[model samples]
Target: MSLIYEARSSSSLLVAGVARGLTTQGGRLVRPAENCWHMVVVRQGGEASMRLVGPWTGAGVASYGEGAEILWIRFRLGTFMPGQPVTGLRDQETLLPAATGHSVWLNDAAWPLPGIDDVDAFVERLRRAGVLTHDPLVQDLLHEPGSGLAPRTERHRLLRATGLPLRHIRQVERAQQAAALLGQGVPIPETMFRLGYFDQPHLTRALRRWVGHTPGQLLRAGEEHLPLRTRPLDAPSLH
Candidate 1:
């Protein structure tokens, strides 16, 4: 859980971040549900592999190696590479073909992986090369709270941008919010009411699907001081 460096993209259209870290001990860690896709590069024993982690609907466990160097780039919700559509990657992990230690083949070209400090520049290159793009309507819909478009139009736009239905997005968002509140020691009844769940069962279903943990499990983990990596990439602060 030790992070060596972390940074976010400077571009407004690309709400993403990069983190590099090393694990002190090797074991399974809970990777909570996330809205964005992750491009991870790991190096161990003089070997490296690049993998793409799609938006996950449920929490999962991932294994890391002790003292391994891990670097990852998490893309924004509505942003994606042209050839690699977000829809195809949903709830799956795909290994990217590598051209070199610091480069991968993307969009029929060799894309040199940028270091933490050069993420913005790399995004700029993607923009110029037509590799990175997002729907303006999707951006507006996510940031504006509400949109005036017709229901059908809004659904279509969201699907085109995020490759998932609005209901799915709301479920993940609510589940994450609930997990955050629970981690903060909020009472279960209060959390249910505040999150607009119909009842305890309703809340439990959402948490089980999106959070991969029940309310009691989350609470116990918090009380027992278990390490859970549920922090959203867009959080203003990093640890």
Candidate 2:
């Protein structure tokens, strides 16, 4: 795997992180299940294109072309487009039509494709245009389950904003925690106990479903194949 991947924390409220990489030789990677949505820009053969990838429900394989340059913008949960409900994009992708070599069509407007250095500014423009927004209701529910809102309303708001059930997000988060622990040389039983899993089998199942790797595989596999978490987006060093 000749993949050179480097991700950094973002200071933007609407973004979780930004990753820029080069796939020197075409290869596949294990993409873990995620609650947050993403926008990916690819530049190869002197052609640029963009795509909106919805929140993934499970682990899968992602392929890249040789010498492909990639910039991935991961949006924080609860951030969404106004008219384009994320519900319809779950587990799928929408390819943004190219307006020019350097821009794409979004909301019937010509939006410039963002380079890695200018992504924060691009996101700010989206916010100013009312094209991207964050839902406080969803954030509140995620932070505190015992919200004042009715159960039905909470579910509706969560689904509408993130296109994912609360339970699904929790499961994915737990699985990620487990993967992090296991990758750091923690024992399986200890990881299970620390994370409140029932047993080894339970931990194994969760990892396989959400992380695409069993506990054993995570320990044995190289870091290149692991779908791992980057640094927190609010880390002071990032700013």
Candidate 3:
């Protein structure tokens, strides 16, 4: 895995107690097969695809529109009750999913979901409605937990325990161009093109979701520090 992870989350009024973070490409993340939930607003570029290799879930191996890039608007969901067969994604622009109360699942797409465009405005509108709230863990994550992500030693247990899927196991096979161009502080449009994303908006949205911060915001945040694995954007990927 060679992705640069910058986790920043602010309290918004839409998702109440939920927090958002950003993760940049360069590494790998492997998710388990359990009945978990996620509200993911993701974007894709190049030949990227997301899949779920498990049983007892909704769709698996979901491929988006084949463009150089694709943007996403998603959310993390949990079980409202003890056992409800995980189902399809939400199609409308409503802030009822998080408000309805579920479990905390990130990047796992086995529950209510929407597209990049659909949930984009919805998040903004919900902020106006005083719905989501930022989480407080952003500060420590900003330090880039030197230990890395939590290891899933109990996949079978969690699968037997939850029934959906675990967080998508991110495998850092490609260095999506965002890390490259953004490293130079280039305008998002050029970076977007370099990353194969459809446009600036798509790139920006992904930056916010995975990395928990925008491209420029990340650059600014790192102005006073250096990463343990820091290297130039033009450098070759480490995977």
C-alpha lDDT values of all predictions: 0.74, 0.85, 0.34
**lDDT tens digits, residue span 122-235, model 2:** 999999999999988877877785688789988988898899989999999999999988888788889998999998899999999999999998766635344333443343
Model 3, range 1-239, lDDT digits (tens) per residue? 22232222223222222222223433233221222233333334422222222221222123223222222222223221122223322211212223212222222322333332244455564334443333222222323442243535344333332333334322111122454456556666676665577766776665544334466764564432122233442444322
Error of 3 at 28 (Å): 4.6
Q: Write the per-residue lDDT of candidate 1 for residues 1-239, one digit (tens) a residue.
A: 43333444455366477776656567776667787887777776776777778787677877776667677788777887777778777789888788887688877898876655676777788888998887777767766766898878988777766778877777899998998888788989999999999999999988877777888887767533344233444554432
Q: What ordering of candidates by lDDT runs from best to worst?
A: 2, 1, 3
Which regions in candidate 2 have their CA more than 4 angstroms from the true location? 222-239
lDDT score, candidate 3: 0.34
Which residue pairs clash in candidate 1?
none
TM-score result, candidate 3: 0.23
**lDDT for position 2 in model 2:** 53
Q: Identify the runs in model 1 with alpha carbons over 4 angstroms from their true place.
A: 1-12, 143-153, 223-239
Q: Between candidates 2 and 3, which one is better according to lDDT?
A: 2
